[model samples]
Target: MSKSAIFTGLVIFIIIALFPFWINFGKTAPVPEPELVGKAKTAKKCVLDKMDMRANHMSLLDEWRDSVVRDANRIYTNTDGKEFAMSLSTGENSCLGCHEDKSKFCDKCHNYASVDPYCWECHTEPKEIK
Candidate 1:
């Protein structure tokens, strides 16, 4: 190949390789961290560790759903042997009690991750009073 053609190809390859880094060079803002909302903020602890919950919350919720709906089980026993009622109506012990504001807590991470969970389709979202 001609020197000029080789140089042009090299330049193009360099630009393509560095384009992504250059585009995001000065973006120092950390990823939006999920904020704990409602009673969760003040709660002693969660059923699972923070990292576990963040990574596997969907699977956990699915398991809970199946246990409650399919198996007709209404109690969840944690690793520590603490039993919690799996009924959605018992908000305090379930999801809504801790995550009182779905918009602030759940929506933040879900929206950031572009995940559209169909949770609200079947379950009623708690109306914010204020």
Candidate 2:
């Protein structure tokens, strides 16, 4: 009887402790999907596969930074055997080259994920997010 009472008490305590959480469950904002526009759309290609990019973009960028700055390697070969400049410059083939509209293309998903990547600190936000 004591064991049963203790288990019941524990269960009640747990429910009470989590009641606030339960009340707000499933109330989060829906996941945001960033859309490509302008050059990003017409290119019909990305540095990696969509799923892979979505999961590992930060890792890929970190690797690119190290390679470009430390090793002076600026060529990135994608899994599809395509080569691209590992640059964040505003050239016609760089990161900002394609993703011209940071607000729509990058910020949507980044904001939804609550991340503030430092990419901007070095590369600078687009002068006009064009």
Candidate 3:
């Protein structure tokens, strides 16, 4: 009697908890695959490794910003001991240098993630040549 009642309550609780997952199981948006163009394709490198950049690029850029502005240090040495200019939208080793096409590379992932990064509030967005 009570055992059956408890079992039914447990089943009900689980169904309620997983209702959203069941409804949206196969309806998720596919992950964005940002395409590289220009220097990025040839260089095949970045200030950090690919996975690290994909996960924590914002944090890395923040550190670079603080270092350059506060300490006047404008160099970034990656794990491979390659040095880069700690810049956002300038220099050949900076973000925009390799990622020239903001629409193809940056916008795809940023939009897919629904992110409106404030980096463009001050930095000029690269002109889309096409």
Cα lDDT tens digits, model 2, 18-130, are: 99899989897677778888888888878998788889988998999999899999898888898889987656778878887788888998897789988887687565544
Residues 83-105 of candidate 1 have per-residue lDDT tens digits of 77675435678877776767777
Q: Which parts of model 3 have CA positions greater than 4 angstroms off?
A: 1-30, 128-130
For each candidate, what TM-score against the reference?
Answer: 0.70, 0.73, 0.73
Clashes (backbone N, CA, C under 3 Å), per candidate, total 0, 0, 0
Best by lDDT: 3
lDDT for each of the candidates?
0.78, 0.84, 0.87
Candidate 2 Cα errors over 4 Å, as ranges:
1-28
Model 1 misplacement above 4 A:
1-30, 87-90, 128-130
* Backbone clash tally (model 3): 0
Sorted on lDDT, best first, the list reads: 3, 2, 1
Query: For model 1, where is the 10-residue window of minimal lDDT?
Result: 83-92
